[model samples]
Target: MTDTLATAEIESTIRSLEDARYAAVVAGDIEGFAAFAHPELLYTHSNAAVDTLDSYLEKLRTGFYVYHRIDHPVHKIVVVGDTVLVSGEMRADITAGGVRKQLANSALAVWVRDGGRWLLLGYGPTVIPGAI
Candidate 1:
């Protein structure tokens, strides 16, 4: 395949994975979400709190973080070597630490190819101006 074709394929796969991951979160499927996560995943919230894979899973398992809805519109996907960077904006209704909130943020997700599969290595979101 040509380089362009290969990149497009990777982009498509990563996009699908992103969608599935968001769906898992909204559905409260810890295991499903875990399937896409790297062992050393670092998830950073817009509030600047960071969670390791274990902590994030625990929050999901215990309902400490409850995702009621998420609308993530990916703007770009860039492939470099075995890594993919996804850029997007996310708007969501969620409850964190027992407090309900709506969120609007610009998000970045990093996925790395490991052991012949793609796993999410890190994710971070920054609150959009005047959006919460």
Candidate 2:
């Protein structure tokens, strides 16, 4: 396939996966979210707290982190061989550690092709100024 075509295909797949990920979080589907998560995933929150995949999942399962809704608008996607970098902004309504909050964040998500599937390797989100 041509480079352009390959890129398009990759972008589409990544976009779908991203959408599904958010949906899973909103729906409190831990297993669904886990399907896309890499074992060594590193997730850094807007508050600068970090979680590995296991910890993140545990939090989700225990209701320590609950997502009510998420609006994520992807700004860019760069495919570098088997790795993909996604730049986006996320606006979310969530409850973290029993405190409800609305968050607007500039988010970066890294996905890596593993075997025949793509897995979320890392994610970091920065709080947007005055967006709380």
Candidate 3:
């Protein structure tokens, strides 16, 4: 396939992965999270808090964050070598550590192709000014 065609295909696949990963949050599916997350994932929240794979999973497992909704309006997706860089807007509602929150964020996620699958390596979001 042409490069452009390949890129489009990869983009679509990555978007599907993102959807599934986010769905896991709403479903509170631990195994689903594990399936999508890389072993070395570093998820940085809009508030600047960071979570490694283990800690992030614990956050869900212990009900520290109960995500009821997650929506990403992806602006850009690029494939560089074996990595896909995703830039997007994040809008979500969640109860974090038992406190309700509505999050509006500018987000980026790095997905690395591992073996035959895409693994989410990192996620970082900054709160959009005046968008909470």
Candidate 4:
């Protein structure tokens, strides 16, 4: 496929993934979140903590962390071959460790096309310190 066509395809797929993630968070669907992630997906936070998909889910389940909603908007997406990158902003309403709070952040995601599926390989986010 031509680079332009490939980029378009990847961008569409990435947009779908982003939408699904937003919905899953609002629904507090762990299964849905798992489907959006690769088995070994590496997620990094602004604080530099990294977690595999499984580990991240474990923290959510075991800690009784409930993510009720995530208001994230994709600003831009760029694709080069098998790698796709996206930049966006997000606001999340979460309940964790007995505290209910809302937070906002800027996020970036990197996806790789493995086989025929676009898998989330890496994601990072910077918390907007005082934005709620």
Candidate 5:
């Protein structure tokens, strides 16, 4: 395939993955989360810490972390060879231990093709002071 075509395809797939991430967070569906994530997925947070998808799912299964709402506004997408990078602003409302709060963030995600499907390889975001 031509480089342009490949880039387009990768960008589209990255957007789709973002949608899935939103859906899973909204529904709090661990099953949906599992479906979209690769077993060996490496996701890094804005805090500079990294966690595997499996480890993330395990934490979810514990029912300890609950997110009430999540919204992501994409700002950019760039594709290079088999890798796609997405940058966006994120707003989230979360409640845990009876404390509910809002969070604003800027996110960057890296996605790569695994066989025929796209899997998120890395994601990092900085917490912004206010909504974007």
Candidate 6:
């Protein structure tokens, strides 16, 4: 059975991984990106597109979506059983389908603990209602 309570230490790990994920995307580090994602990630974007882990990684690697830089602030992490949920604000410079796209977002990510390691199992990021 999975532990329902995550220690403050575990919570710290969660935050660090969140930082690392955005960093890896900006760096275009394929291995790092893959390491951060779980086998069955279901990600929904602010633009209303949805992807599984493989599809998402493929698009990133191919420049279908280019992540230039990312900043996450006001993030909160909570744990329930083996699942970790994160909610936050995101700002970034990005391109989608060869067009520069707005990047301000309100994001949520779900990470699952598997074999004692945390892997991002899902992501949903909604665009901020209005922007420059």
Per-prediction TM-score to the true structure, in the order listed:
0.98, 0.98, 0.97, 0.86, 0.83, 0.91
Q: Which stretches of candidate 6 lie over 4 Å from their true place?
A: 1-6
Residues forming the 10-long window of minimal summed lDDT in candidate 6? 1-10
lDDT of 1 by residue, 1-132 (tens): 999999999999999999999999999999999999999999999999999999999999999999999999999999999999999998999999999999999999999999999999999999999875
Q: Give the winner by lDDT: 1 or 3.
A: 1
The regions of model 2 sitting more than 4 angstroms off are none
Candidate ranking under TM-score, highest first, comes to 2, 1, 3, 6, 4, 5
Q: Please count the clashing residue pairs in each candidate, in the order shown.
A: 0, 0, 0, 0, 0, 0
* Per-residue C-alpha lDDT of model 4 across residues 67-88, encoded as one tens digit per residue: 7777888999988777888999
Candidate 4 accuracy as lDDT = 0.81
How much lDDT does candidate 5 score? 0.76
In model 3, which regions exceed 4 Å deviation? none
lDDT, residue 105, candidate 1: 96
lDDT of each: 0.97, 0.97, 0.93, 0.81, 0.76, 0.86
Candidate 3: what lDDT? Answer: 0.93
lDDT of 5 at 21: 78
- Candidate 5's C-alpha runs over 4 A off are 46-49, 96-98, 130-132
> Worst ten-residue run, lDDT, model 1?
123-132
Model 2 root mean square deviation, Cα atoms: 0.6
**RMSD of each candidate?**
0.7, 0.6, 0.8, 1.9, 2.4, 2.7
Our model 4 lands, by Cα RMSD against the true structure, at 1.9
C-alpha lDDT (0 to 100) for residue 61 of candidate 6: 85
Which lDDT tens digits does candidate 2 get at residues 1-29?
99999999999999999999999999999
